[model samples]
Target: MSALPWMQHLIVVPVLLPLLVGALLIPVAQNRHGFKFAASAVSGVLLWLLSLALLGMADGGHWPDGIGVYLASNWAAPFGIALMVDRLSALMLVLTSTIALAALVFGARRWDRVGVHFHSLFQFLLMGLNGAFLTNDLFNLFVFFEVMLAASYGLVLHGYNLRRIQAGMQYVAVNLVASLLFLIGVSLIYGATGTLNIADLTLRVAALGPQDTYLLRIGASVLALAFLTKGAMWPLGFWLPTTYAAASPPVAAMLVLMTKVGVYALLRVWLAVFGDAAGELEGFGLAALSVGGMATLLFGAVGMLASQDGGRMAGYGAIISSGTLLAVLGHSGSAVLASGLYYLIGSTLAMAAFMLLIELTERIRPPGAALLAITMEAFAIEDKPEDPVGVGIPGTLAFLGLSFVACALVISGMPPLSGFVAKFSLFHALLAMPGRVPPATWLLIALMLLAGLAAIIALMRLGVRTFWASGAVTPPRLQISEVLPVGGLVALCVALTLQAGAVFDYLSRTVDGLARSGSYTERVLGEPPVMRPAGGEVAR
Candidate 1:
């Protein structure tokens, strides 16, 4: 394998593999379920393995500054499409592939059969996600963003019920507007800097005059709005809960990482292009980001309390996680950012597992029971029914119940879990800051505590209603395929908890390396540009 020709092209494989597989699967007949599942599963496993290898290479410093730059068609950076794999991007790729594999396995049981070309769409989505993470330029980022959004539109409506269609419509509308803003912002930035490559932009931004700097700031603000919308920031995020809730469980679980894409863009752009080197623009939007992040946290907390549906609750949990990360990034400290990265990974895993668990647990209730409860509450009616007491609960039920509790603890940032470790690290980072803590930082701390409290209350209520209330319990027929994914994610969270020191060390180094924009620029654009005649085409 090491001697293989394609092994040298590892960076592009993450995107190319999925794109080819998905495109090929489009022509396969739907009746070939065996072929579809086998193809998709094998692709998923290979993707996961590839991401692991990339992660190891990046973390082990096999590449210079833990950065691997791949030029398409042998064209130099800032001229042709380039893919960059660093510790941060590699980590994201690993997470994306891990979740993709789990979601595919879980959906293979039945959800994949509900729609034509499900596997194809899923693979395309993976391609888009991986490309978005790896692309070195904002233009390609927008392209990959649209690809991901398009695949998500299909997946969101995959199980095509009326409710899903309605939710998908809203989702589509919001993202379309976001995509437009993303394009406009990119155009503005390119106009200002004469380049779309992030590394080049970082160098160009430092040399801009006051007028161009103002324009660049405006462009960055517009881009930030686009990203904030996708990140589920308040006022722009009203569609998220309904959209996420409407999607099938496996799809919803996969969708958990989508918001992080926005967060990743923010971190990359902020640290690379707008860091301390951009004299006038240094920390230009941090204030707004912090304020918006706090608002998002507040919104998520209120929404969590108001939510009666498990899916909606999980969606709010995602919002909370996004908000926390946004606020921490605004702090502009490497330690805090490292802790935020840890929190980001832990929260995403816990939320994905919880989203998967919601569908399984909800199946245990009698049909229409939730609707009946709502109707009863609205009509001010109370009904208590006698229940048989001596029978023991099923093993599946107990497993799900315990899983739910673990998820709850993780989401709420309780003790003895990765979530708690992440929050604790954040707290320590905040306290360890060199200067006196600002009022805004204090407010962020307060909100973080409150958000956890809200999660605890909401999840406790949900647990009581679902697992403790008196009712006829209908045990859900659990499949090993479904159960394994949920368990695997939870186990990963536990692993993260146990390996916190090592993980934090890696993340800290990643953050430190990100602060050195010159190294990145040198590594990406140091090679000579490829010159071609006007009539000839270059192959990528």
Candidate 2:
């Protein structure tokens, strides 16, 4: 179209600005902590402002037809990489930036002290994240994904301990394979459709006959597998707990955005490309997706029930939430979009708080002999450091307990919080679906309820151990620095509950954007009725 708007410039700036600052932060990583922090702040502020600008534009119904494409060397789509932000991408942008900023501020405390290049790696990771979320081309998406993973390699191994090294190795290995699958999938799709632009592929993949359906399905499966690895869905997610546990808290919190990218890609590409394929089959993929989603939900709950460690437990909970979202996606009913969006918000918020709580607990517990004496009095041979039994709370532990309660209720889907609101919307969506209710759907509901109960029990056990148990040891007092982060998150959760109506409406609008992929394709591709192929010709 005409010259690119100033706002589109803001989008690319978030991606490139961080990379420049991250590189700059590296050489000064050791000596000038203040400089690193300032660099981080500048990058973080720009990202936040960019996100807010996108949101404002979206609110004003900012659709200017003819694609908002930013091309390097002035090459167009299908030949050159491009960054494109639709309404949904912009929403994710804001959410990712907000969470990253919070986590960076929380994480910098230790990284700044330890001579680590935390600021640099953090910015690099953000660069990867922002680029991945905003890019319109598949190859460009892969590039951004790898860029993010590389930064993760450094962040996960930041401490250089045996645990960090081992965990990072596993994390890198799993994702490397995932990246390969991603590239292979891209190649297959390209070979089949002769285009890598996602919007173009959506128009082409359906034209190939049923004979080629197998290849398309295989391609879709490969891409889904790569994302599943990212989403931490069951059987593919073993690396998440170990790697996240080993990393610093901010790093773990920051990494949460990555899985959502996987989920986002799954939602975006499948709906944009393959959903059109399944349109003729009455949404056949929904059944398979629901089955996998239920399995993941149950798998994660089982892991949570069997584990006592706080960090690992939080990781399992995250997996469970991911499954819940996937399951929502599998429901082909009208409300599925709303349900998926609500659950997405709830799960992200709960997981964020849970990660922070785990870090807080580890920091507050007493070390060594005193810790042992307390455990001995409580009748345990060794201190299960993850569950600190017999500790009395008067200062920091009290506030931590308060946080734990918020985390437990929100995560367990208790009422009056965002989690409950989200789940309620999903359940309502489920029941509203037409035709006979499938056994699998009912099973999912039951499993979700069961998972909620199990998470509640685990969280209760943890709370009693760390906050309420009567024994020999006292918890270290919390500094404002520590409390502020946890307190701020808790406050945010409370606000989420208070503004449930407004948030739910926001979620509804977002889901509307998701469910109607035609509108999205139309907006990006400058065509109305972005339809699938049908009757031996590409459907329009």
Give candidates' CA RMSD values in order.
3.3, 6.6
Model 2, span 1-540: residue lDDT tens = 234455556657878888999988777738777677877977897888888887667655665431345555445555666677766777788878877777767766665455378788888899998888888888888999999999888888886788888888999999999999999888876766678888777667657777566666677678778888998877888888787677777777777667788888877776777654344533546666777778888988888888667777887888888888777777553357766766676667667767866877765555553354446646865534355477444776678777888878888888777778777777777777788887776888898898888888877776655654434446765556566666777787788778878767776676666566566555555522223344544332
Give the alpha carbon lDDT tens digit for every residue of 1-540 in model 1.
012135448999999999999999999999888899999999999999999999998888677888888888778888988899999999999999888888888888799999899999999999999999999999999999999999999999997999999999999999999999999999999888899999898888879988888889889989998999999988888899998899998899888999899999988988888787877777778878888888999999999999999999999999999989988887644558989999999999999999889988888777777776666667877667656498787989888998898899999999899989999889888988888888887899999999999999999988866875526777789999999999999899999999999998999889888988889889888744444446564322
TM-score per candidate, in order?
0.94, 0.89
Which residue pairs overlap in candidate 1's backbone? none
Clashing pairs in 2: 533-539
Evaluate model 1: give its lDDT. Answer: 0.88
**Residue 342 lDDT in model 2?**
62
Model 1, position 67, has a per-residue lDDT of 86
lDDT of 2 at 388: 42
Candidate 2, position 148, lDDT: 93
Residue 259, candidate 1: alpha-carbon lDDT: 89
Using lDDT, give the best candidate's number: 1
